[model samples]
Target: MSLALDLAPSASVEVRNVDLAYTRKARGTAPLSRFAVQADGAALASVPDEMEVRSSHLVRFSPTGKPATLQTYSVETLRKVEISTSGDTFIGSTDDDLYVFKDNKKSRFLSDRRANYTDIALSESGSRFGTVFCDMLAAHHTVALGDQTGRTLWTKDLPFAASAVAVSRDGSVIAVGGEDGDLWLLDNARNTVLKHRQEAAMEAVAVAGTNRVVFASGGGAGVINAEGQLLWFTEIVGETVALGTDSVARTVAVLARTDTNAGRLILLSGENGLPVWEIDYEDSRPTGLSVSANGEFVGVSLRDGTVCVYKLFYGDRLAAADGEAVLAEARAARSGDGSLLQAVALLQARLGSVPSDFRACDLLKETLTDAKEQALALSANAEEIGDFLSA
Candidate 1:
């Protein structure tokens, strides 16, 4: 079967055999789908508690859709999780420990105080990660940064209990938001660079690029620069559920409830915090929100465990048309001429528009090697012809 999607004005692309499914009540917090698109244009999603027993699973799908399991990791009490831009590295926190999964190995790090982690964020490169920890007994909170091996680099104490934490794309800066309506910007050395006060309690925080950080508090959201100056602020109806930002795209995605208690996802410009687009859903509340690094897609995960991905267009007609044409050629050539180059290109293009499609990439790599060998043989024949002519 084929599906034609109108992603932007005057542009439509046909996707083949694409299907999506969701597992209900996957976890308390919404899951994150790393890059929205893998290197080969496949989409990847991380759903927590997919198999029960506090286990989380990584799933891969395509624009011409088929969903498949990529990997599964089990923990004692999974709390917060973040996936790297490449979708290969995973950082998560449990009730008392932090975990990092990379290269098919799992590493666990213990906290100094055995606190419950409330939120976690990772840099785009996945080399650094940060977490917000709450000390229930001490009635204090802490923000800690760690490397890929799960070693804590630095930890900063917060005056109020922190509700969310985020790190910049390059891991050079960190943003922490507290339940007491305070936002703090810190450097990599864990020193407070700037702080701002809001009107309501902070629910989420996300860092975009190097100079901007966005946070949601109660029913309101605001953007601030690294200098602590408020860039803009906007208020929405009902409670704010989640916030996400694409540092490369400089766009922010906010999830909130309506007056009637319906869920709505709003896309805003990170530069000035202006609304770009908004979508409403009648069934479930959004538990998580994410935007692709290129601002090409936004993903929303609902309370019922449904993860929906939408394509965003910034007016590249040539790229869109080329992607569509290559996808069509790849689909047709799948059982015909076997053009590995076209397939590889199609996969790469598809990833820019969708989430993960690792299976397609894996399958096409073998064909790519064969194609390379055939080209080498043809080059050898050409060289022989040249030598014969010379003789």
Candidate 2:
């Protein structure tokens, strides 16, 4: 699990299910909501009176959105933060600089020649790091490779600014996703190995193996071999909202329309790009998604600042056993003549595994909307799942 990458912007977290499927163990909004931004540069929330404009730091929030104890830094706004697999070193980025934290000491520098860093990545070994620099005046984007001590290794200009970047486990390969819908594979020396182009931007890229690359885009998810041939492509209808942060068992990705919150979380084999299973989570607008390296957990963060995590169960019979188990529990809950509160608790339990059936998702929505006619809106049911959707 040496690979780490960043997702698009949105508010914080809520749910804290650590069961056998998707699991963020929580998600809560950060006191510093500037991390959640609109692509159009709209206002989100104001900074606290005690915090200074230059006093930048990364705050850890429990799934409930309350601040947890963590270290702090001075890179204003702290755009994106990633740590090595060892969890000893960390890399944080800003619009113009990159910060490296190790051994309880920190160092900062403007990486490479370009500025306006939009995205950041760190290798699993914590030996290497990279940045996506956007030169707005020149109308182009650049990628920079560097070492852990705040040193720039090399910079490669891109046809367009990159939307995301990922580093391989061994720290030898780098994947860059461009706004122009191109995926570039670069070696340690910055040589281009493969360039896969598409009509949509790449939301994420992973080094599945030596020439095996996994990518998620607006169209769908797929894999390619060293020769750059399309190994397999799963056609998705709209934009890819988030991708599972899978470095070992690359198994899941999220898809949804840009204009709506309806989304599909697809678990694929990662071998042939065939669908293993899919779940519908209309819980909230998914801003981020990823599966644990062991393939046992999946996490989805919604736009309302709620982070929902699920623990997964595996099976050889991928067709129905996995999904059937979910619906079975839902049915059992209803057959027991369970109260709506119990259903909401079960709803929180199956947050990400609500079956591929849209009816279950519709039920959550319809039940939440009936708040006008019933007290359910202000009940724990709302606090459970309804709270996120209201945002």
Question: What C-alpha lDDT do the candidate models reach, one value each?
Answer: 0.67, 0.57
Tens-place lDDT digits, model 1, residues 16-36:
212222232334434553344
Model 1 clashes, total count: 11
Give the poorly placed runs of model 1, Cα more than 4 Å off: 1-30, 33-42, 48-55, 259-261, 315-391
Q: Compared with the true structure, what per-residue lDDT tens digits does model 2 show for residues 1-391?
A: 1112221122121111234321222333321111121111111211222445554333342333444434444445565566554445677776777788776578875633556777777775678887777774758788888888877788888887688887776678888888778888898899998888878878777664455677777577777667676666676655776555345434544445444866656666555454545656675665555454555556555655555555555433223344456556655655565455555555545546434334456555654554344574457676877668887
Q: Estimate each model's TM-score.
A: 0.68, 0.62
In candidate 2, how many Å is residue 284 off? 3.4
Residue 14 shift from truth in candidate 1, angstroms: 25
Model 1, residue 367: C-alpha shift (Å): 58
